[model samples]
Each structure stands twice: as structure tokens, then as C-alpha cells.
Target: MSTTSDLGTHGERIAAAYLTDRGLRVLDRNWRCREGELDIVAREGDALVFCEVKTRRAVGFGHPAEAVGHAKQRRLRTLAQRWLAAHDEHAPDLRFDVVAVLVRAGRPALVTHLRAAFS
Candidate 1:
């Protein structure tokens, strides 16, 4: 709740619930490896979704989803490959998604989900 990591964790929880409510079955949260971490892994029909959650108290700098640039997208892709190798799950499609959470002091957090955010 105090640190940025804590805020991120909070956002990820919100994102997971939101996705579930929308019918995506969450398979993993904070999945990690030597390469890096994936914020969420989900199944939506025949696709496997690898999601990144970004949270911020405000948007003075930029929107949270903007944080996932080209380099970060590449890393996520590599991490997705590693995750697939480590798990037994399979899907006919693969997707990358971004969940942006904006938390305010006196209001409920606002969540924006971007599906197929990258290749």
C-alpha cells in the first residue's frame, strides 16, 4: 500500500478480478522465472493470454499502458515462451494484453484493458 510494488500488487488483484468477471479464466498471477515475471496469464476461449498490469496514482507522466514499450513487450514475449515450456497448458492462439489501473485517493480504481496489445 505504501511502496510502488504494493500498489502494483493491488492493481494486479483488481485486474485479475475484472478479467474474471468478463469471462477470462485466470490461470496464473505473478508468475516468475529467471528471465522475468508475467503479471497475469489467462485463458479466453481458445487463446492463451499473457497480460501486463501497470498501475499509477495519477497520469501526470503518461498512461500506465505506455510503460510497456517495445523492449518490455519483447521481454514479455520471451517470458511467455518460458512459461509455456514450464507449463502443460496449450492453446491455438496467443495474445498479449495490458491492464492499466488508475487509483485515486477517494474514488474506485479505474481499469482499462487493452487486448492484443502487441504481436
Candidate 2:
């Protein structure tokens, strides 16, 4: 894979581990539809979390989380609805999160998890 795609995949794996360590159970990764893709789907207690992961080697443009702006947030919301429609057994308790990962020299320098990132 290309460097950018590799970094994104690495970041998602790391993010999954980090969340699972904190008691969240991973339900899916890279879930895609015609609308878009969801980086991670997990359950934290009673809530279903739809996560967007942004990975970067440097922040020359902006922080990784900043990449998930309004447009992306809107898309995530719509995608979440699509996901829910496909899985009717899930509870309505839902949350949107953003995980920002910064890599340096092929190692993760920082990973930030922001829960309830948007409505």
C-alpha cells in the first residue's frame, strides 16, 4: 500500500487496541457503503460508537482531528444512520468520535480520542 494508506490502517489498528483496552468491544473496522466509510464501530457499555480516525505524519496543514470538519461530520452522521438501518438489533444509544493519530518515523507519537465529537 502507499504510505498514506499504510499510516491510516496502522492508526486504525492502534486506535482499536487502545479502545479495546479501555473496555470497548470492536464491532467493525473500515465499514463502507456507497455513502462513505466508517473507521471503527465499537460498543462502549451501552452506547454504540461510530469513530472517524485521522492519521498524519505531520501537522503542516492542521491537526489530524481538524481534518474531520463539518462536511465529514455530516457524512459520518448519515453513514451511521445507514449502519443502524442495516443493524436493527443495536440500541439507539449512539455516539460519534474522532481519533487523531500523529506518526513520526513510522511510530505513533500521539493518539487523541475525542468522544461525542458531533451531533
Candidate 3:
């Protein structure tokens, strides 16, 4: 895989691990539908979480979370709906979250989780 794709995959894995450690049970990763993609799907308490993970080698130009724009948020929401339908999951509370990862040479992983990132 290309460096960028590798970084993204790594970010997702790390995000998955981080959330699992926080006692969230993951329902799926890379959940998809015609509407779009959800990088991570997990359950926190009784609510369902749809997570978008943004990973960058370095954020010299912009922050990693900046990668997800309004349009992307809307698409994620649509995809979440499709995913819930396909899995026959109950219509519980839904939330959009973002996990931003910044990787720098010889540095520790910089991960940030923003809950309620989008409506």
C-alpha cells in the first residue's frame, strides 16, 4: 500500500484499539453502504458511535481532523443509517466522532478523539 493509505489503516487500527481499551465494543470497521464509508462503528454505553478516522504523516498544512468536511460528515451519517438497516440494529442514539492521528518520524503517536464531532 502507498504511504498515505498505510497511515490511514494504521490510524484506524490504533483508534480501534484505543476505543476498545475504553470499554467500547466495536461492531464493525470500514462499514460501508452506497452512501459512503464509516471508518469505525462501536457501541459506547447504549448509544451507537460512527467514527471517522483521519490520519496524516504530518500536519504541516492542516490538522488531521480538518480532512473531514461538512459533506463528508453528511455522507457518514447516510452511511451509518444504511449500516444500521443492513445489520437490523435497533434505532438507538447515534453519534458522530472523529479520531485524528498525527504521525511524525521518531515520535509517539498523537491521537485525539473528539466526541459529537458532527450532528
Candidate 4:
């Protein structure tokens, strides 16, 4: 991708497809609020899943998943609550997931799905 946003958008698309292929029905994408944006929202059976997608052209700094530290996780949790409130959606269980995409030149992007990444 030419820009970071483009790469991120591409990664989100791949992550959504990956989740669908794994049987999670996608509910929302790029859900935004005054707080922040949620990369993906999905469901698997009776559980509601909130996914954070991180994309990087290289891992010189660290893995993409590493980008979602405690602060980000906290924000995501708040966003999830807001999402539920806005949609009036209920689930017996809630989960947080992280989809890390590593793009390499001339090679397929590597995907790592960390389920229940944080509380």
C-alpha cells in the first residue's frame, strides 16, 4: 500500500475475512465513536467479539500485536461498552481479539489471531 492508512485498511479487510473463514460472523467494521474506532466487531455462537487489527510493513520495532498495549486495551474495552450500549446488543460472553498482520515485500502477509487477547 502507498500509505499507512491504506495498509491498515487492507489489513482490516484481511482480518475480517479471516474471522469469517473461521466461522465468526462479522457485525461491524471500522465502528467509530467520539472515543475511538473499533476495527472489527463479530460474533461466534453466543459470544460477542471485539477485534483490534494492527498492520505493519515491518517488525523492526516489534510485532504488530505488541502495539496494543495496556492503554490501548483499556480504550478498546471502553469502546466495546459504548458499542454495546449504542447497538443494544447482548451476549452471554464477551471477548477481545487482536489480529496482527505482517506484510513483507513479495510475500504473502502473515496473520496472527490472538483470541481473548485481553480482558
Q: Rate the local accuracy (lDDT) of all candidates.
A: 0.97, 0.89, 0.87, 0.96
Q: Is candidate 1 or candidate 2 better by TM-score?
A: 1
- Most TM-score-accurate candidate: 1
TM-score of every candidate relative to the true structure: 0.98, 0.92, 0.92, 0.97
Q: Give the TM-score of candidate 3.
A: 0.92
Two-way lDDT contest, 3 vs 4, winner: 4
Off by over 4 Å in 4: none
lDDT (Cα, tens digit) per residue for candidate 2, span 12-74: 988898889889999989989999999999998889999999988889999999999899999
Deviation in angstroms for 55 in model 4?
A: 0.3
Report the lDDT tens digits of candidate 3 across residue range 15-113: 999889999899999976666678999999878999999988877879999988998988887888788878966646889999998877788788899
In candidate 1, what are the lDDT values of residues 2-113, reduced to their tens digit? 9999999999999999999999999999999998999999999999999999999999999999999999999999999999999999999999999999998989999999
Better of 1 and 2 by lDDT: 1
What's the distance in Å from true for residue 37, model 4?
0.4
* Residue 81 local lDDT, model 1: 99
Better of 2 and 4 by lDDT: 4
lDDT of 1: 0.97
TM-score of 1: 0.98
Off by over 4 Å in 1: none
